[model samples]
Target: MDRVRLLVLLTVFVDILGLGVVIPVLPFYVERFSNSPQAVTTLIAVYAAASFLSAPLIGVLSDKYGRRPALIGSILSTSLGWFIFASGKSLLVLYVGRIIDGLAAGNLPVAQAAITDTVKDEKERGQVLGYVGAIFGIGFIIGPAIGGALGHLSVTLPFWFVGALAAVNAVLAYFFLPETRKQQEAHTHPISLNPFSPMKRAIQQKDMCSNYLAWGMFGLAVASTQSVYALFLNVAFGWEEFMVGLLFMATGIVLAVNQVFAMRNFWLKKFTEPKLELWMTAAFAFGYVLIGVASFPLFIVGAILTTFGQSVLRVVMNSQMIAKSNPTRRGEVMGISASIVSLTAAIAPLFAGWLFDLRPSLPFFAAAVFLGIGFFILYSAQKTLPTTLDPRQPVVSEI
Candidate 1:
């Protein structure tokens, strides 16, 4: 791999590591202040809501300014948020911390833009994105194990450790990662604070709108289930933090193996990206149904299926989106994609949390329903996609 891609991958790794460390421990940590499962999911929703409002602006800035600064700023903000969450005594303080972090949670999108900025070929871009997903899986594999160990000692320790890692990541990014955006042709359009503007612009394009809708529903399925994963395990199977972490690690292993091996060797080689997208959706829907069943072995099978589906779907969708975007607006388009996911992240958790309180299986059932719908949308929209999956001419949109 080239220096830029390697550095971008490193940045993504650190970000995901911190996130992985927190996920298994968050519900237990929050229970100290509030016993409600809703509190835990709400905290996640707060962060996503803030990210939804700010990520687009951050992407615009990266397009105008450079990827390096946006990346560094986002990492630094994440560190601060972790620190605040670690020190907080009340749930409100935790919300404030997540809000701060979410407002600058543009690291993944900006990092992706940086990687794509270096590659011109659509096929090569898809391969590179698989590497990103692989790194994400690697982070998950290691982070949760460490987090479980740390949480066993003290719930706050994981946060502090992740915070410190984020801080160090910001420093590495600043000193080593070079700017990837071409300064000469940077967008000169006036910066817009309205986060929805990019979404609106994206939706105006017919093909892009179709993909975004599918992506949004996919986001809803993943986000809602993710928010309650640990809690569901605890409630249904009586798994503690350590057991939950191990489960997460197992799923991460599936994710990493698929991204690293299955993606290049099996899935991509066997199916076209469009076909993979549709098949993965079916895999997700069935997986969620199995997960909603009240059996431990069935749940494990479902988790594996969903994780595999998620890993492949994410890469193919991103590659397809990149092929459809104008070179000048790659950053903007990535930001819009992240924003759509974040919007779903913000909305899904609340509804899922409510459903979970009523019955642990309800959220998974809801997620399955969303995936079923997403599959139909993507299948219907296939006719509108480019016949060759090659990069198209820039679709001009209103600034």
Candidate 2:
């Protein structure tokens, strides 16, 4: 791997590592102030809401200014957010911390843009993106276990550790991570502060609307289940924090193995990105159904299946999006994608929390419905969606 890709991947790994550390323990941490599931989900929604508002602007900024600065700024913001969240004594403080982090949550998009800037080949780009997903899995594999151990000692310790890690990450990035955006391409477009403007423009583009909508629905499905996962495990199976963390670690293992091995060796070799995308949505739908069953073994199976499916599908879909979008506007398109996911995340948690209060399994069922709808959208629009496999064909160029 090249230096740019390595640095970008390292940055992404650390960012996700912090998130993985928090995922299993966040509910327990929030319970110190408020024990309600709604409170926990509400905190998640607040962050996603903030992210939805800022993602596009961050994208545009990276496009105009440079990815390195945007990446460094985002890392610093995340470190600050974690510090505040770790030190918070009240629920309001927690919300404020999350909002700060969310507002500058442009790390992944910028990192992706950096990779795209460096690597020009579409097929190789897909493989590199799989590596990104693999890193996420690897981070989760280690981070959750560490978080669980630290949380067992003190709930706040894990957060503090992640905050420190982010600080160090930022320093490393500042010294080592090189700017990847081309100078000629930089400063070509005027910056737009309105987050919704980019999103509206994305939807207005031909062959992108259905893709964006499908991605949004997929995000909603994942977010709904994820926001309530720890609570669901606790409620459904009387599992504690350690076990919940371990379960996530197991899922991460599944994700890592699938992305690294199954993707390069089996899936991509056998099927095209579009075909895998449609099929994976169906797999996700089925997995959610199995997860909704109030059985531990069934839930484990479902989790593994869904994790594998999602890890592959995410990479494939993103590869398709990058291929279809204009090369100069990759950052903007990636930001729009992030914003759509953020929007769904903002909405899904509230609905999931409500459904969880009604019935533990309802949220998973709702997730299945969302994936089913996404599957339908993709299936119906499959013919219209352009593929990058044919180098002779023109991709979507209109901004």
- Model 2 lDDT, full chain set: 0.87
Please provide, for model 2 over 1-399, each residue's C-alpha lDDT reduced to its tens digit, 9 standing for 90 to 100: 888889999999999999899998999999999978999999999999999988878888888889999989989999999999999999999999999999998999888877877655756777788889999999999999999999999999999999999999999999999999888767576666777888777867877778888899999999999999889888899998999999889888988998788888888888888888899999998899999997878987888779978998889877777777765677787888888899999999998999999999999999999999999999998876554443213266556
* TM-score of each model, in listed order: 0.97, 0.97
lDDT of 1 at 142: 92
Tell me the tens digit of each residue's lDDT in model 1 across 1-399.
787889899999999998899889999999999998889889999999999988888888899998999999999999999999999999999999999999998999999888988876766777888989998899889989999999989989999999999999999998999999887648788877887777677768776777889999999999989999888988899999999999889888989999988888888878889898999999989999999996989988898889998999999998888888777778887888899899999999999999998999999999999999999998888876554466545444434
| Clash totals for all candidate models | 0, 0
**Predictions: Cα RMSD each:** 1.4, 1.5
lDDT of each: 0.88, 0.87
Among all windows of ten consecutive residues in candidate 1, which has the lowest summed lDDT? Answer: 390-399
In TM-score terms, candidate 2 sits at: 0.97
